[model samples]
Target: MAKNNEFLWRRLHSLLGIIPVGLFLTQHLIVNHFATKGVDAFNEAAHFMESLPFRYALEIFVIFLPLMFHAFYGIYIAFTAKNNTQRFSTFRNWMFVAQRITGIFLVIFIAWHVYETRWQVAIGADKADFNMMADILGNPWMFGFYVAGVLAATFHLANGIWSFLVSWGITQSAASQRVATYVTLGIFVALSVVGIRALLAFVV
Candidate 1:
């Protein structure tokens, strides 16, 4: 029973970590979404986040802590998985591959995003300065990279949400499950378009 308890306990953490990350990503996207309205719009929102002391405290607890736990658990899962990719051949099986690919994308993109934005803020520069964003967007390479990141991150969030629900026993019926997965997929594509459109508005 102890082993069973441990399994359930770990699953609890995984569920909490998973859903929280998705919700937070939406919030993050909304903040970045302000970029669509131009730098001042993004700057106004970004300044509020960085300038406020209370918000910093919230970031430490809400963003950093959970992010650490979730990333670690994700790495653990990826490394310990005994199932080979070729072990299955269905569309469902392809999801595992897709998940890993996007997971890697998010990790890399988030690191670069922090280096560009948060790192500047750390050194007393306004990371959200509209001018900085404009400068970055002026680079075709950087712009392309961000476009890809936004797409991959959206897919990772939406698809992962459905997977989390199934793993947590939340969406149970086969018909309901199928519908939920489809809806999550649709949401992913919709968000990707929103994100790309936002980027284009900034660039053009």
Candidate 2:
């Protein structure tokens, strides 16, 4: 029973990553890309998001809850699982380690990002807009941090998708897994480009 529960939770964790969390990340990148069109366009996008009916409720269920579960359960998995990459240098093994490492980095980055943007706006201390992002990213140090964070996040999501396929038994054969890996690599590259472009829109 305990083992079954563990399996179920792990499955749920993987499902959450590809569903609401992953979908949210894609939407976030698209919205942030509007910054390239200037402040007006960016703010208009923000206003549209805010104007959605029951936006806060949607945020709680679709964004916050899933994100929190995925992160915490991920941390639990990371801590409980053994890392044998050093002993066995295989591609899949290294990717397993990389997933954990990136997950840790993302937790820190996401917390800081949410506090600086969402929490501040909620408390009336800041507004979510292009100017706010520009101010944050204008600093060289902050810009570098964002670049690193975005890359880590992109890799994590892409790799998570690959893992999700295997976990759900969608890619069972070695050939299929390899194809999924290549596809995920392509996704990582594409998302990285979009993410970096969004970041540059603020500073450049």
Candidate 3:
């Protein structure tokens, strides 16, 4: 019974990570990427999202709840799961280690990021505009932190995609898994560029 419950939870975790959570991340990166165009472009995109009907309700139900489950359960998995990187010392083993490390880091990174941006906006302490990001990223330390956060986020999502495919039985063959690795690597690189460019736009 316990094993079956855990299996279902793990499957749910995998599904949620790819569904609303992954989709939200992709939309967020795309919106932020508008920064590369100009302040007005970014602000327009942000404003459009902010103006969506039932936005708060959507965020709570679709984004936050699923994310909290994924994050918290992921933390549990990270600590409990065995990492055989040293003994096995294979590519996938190393990836497993990296995934856990990044997952833990992302919990910290995402919380701080939300506190700084979304929470602040909710409390009327800040605006969701380019200038707001500019003020935040103007500091060298914060800029470095944000860059690291972006890299971590992109890597986590990309790698998580590979895991999601295998766990969901979409990638049954070794060759398919290898292809997934390459595809996800490309996704990581592309999203990293987009995220870093957006951050650079804010500061530079």
All candidates: CA RMSD (Å): 2.6, 1.3, 1.3
Per-residue error for 96 in candidate 2, Å, reads 0.5
Instruction: Assess the local accuracy of residue 51 in candidate 2 as a C-alpha lDDT between 0 and 100.
Output: 86
Tens-digit lDDT string for candidate 2 (1-204): 434588889899999998999999988988888988888999999989988999999999999999999999999888887899779999999999999999999999999999999999999999988889999999999999999999999999999999999999999999999999999999999999999998998887
lDDT tens digits, residue span 84-187, model 3: 77799999998899999988998999999999999999999999999999999999999999999999989999999999999999999999999999999999
Root mean square deviation (Cα) for candidate 3? 1.3
Q: How accurate locally, in lDDT, is each candidate?
A: 0.76, 0.93, 0.93
Instruction: Look at candidate 1 and tell me the lDDT of residue 136.
Output: 84
Candidate 3 global lDDT = 0.93
What residue pairs clash in candidate 2, if any at all?
none
Task: Tell me the TM-score of each prediction against the true structure.
Answer: 0.86, 0.96, 0.96
Candidate 2 regions exceeding 4 Å error are: 1-4
Clashes of each: 0, 0, 0
lDDT of 1 by residue, 1-204 (tens): 434575764685567555577677777777777888876788798778677778777777777777766666666666665656676777666777677677767777888888788887778775567677778888999999999899888887777877877887889998878998899999898788777876776677
Q: Estimate the lDDT of model 2.
A: 0.93
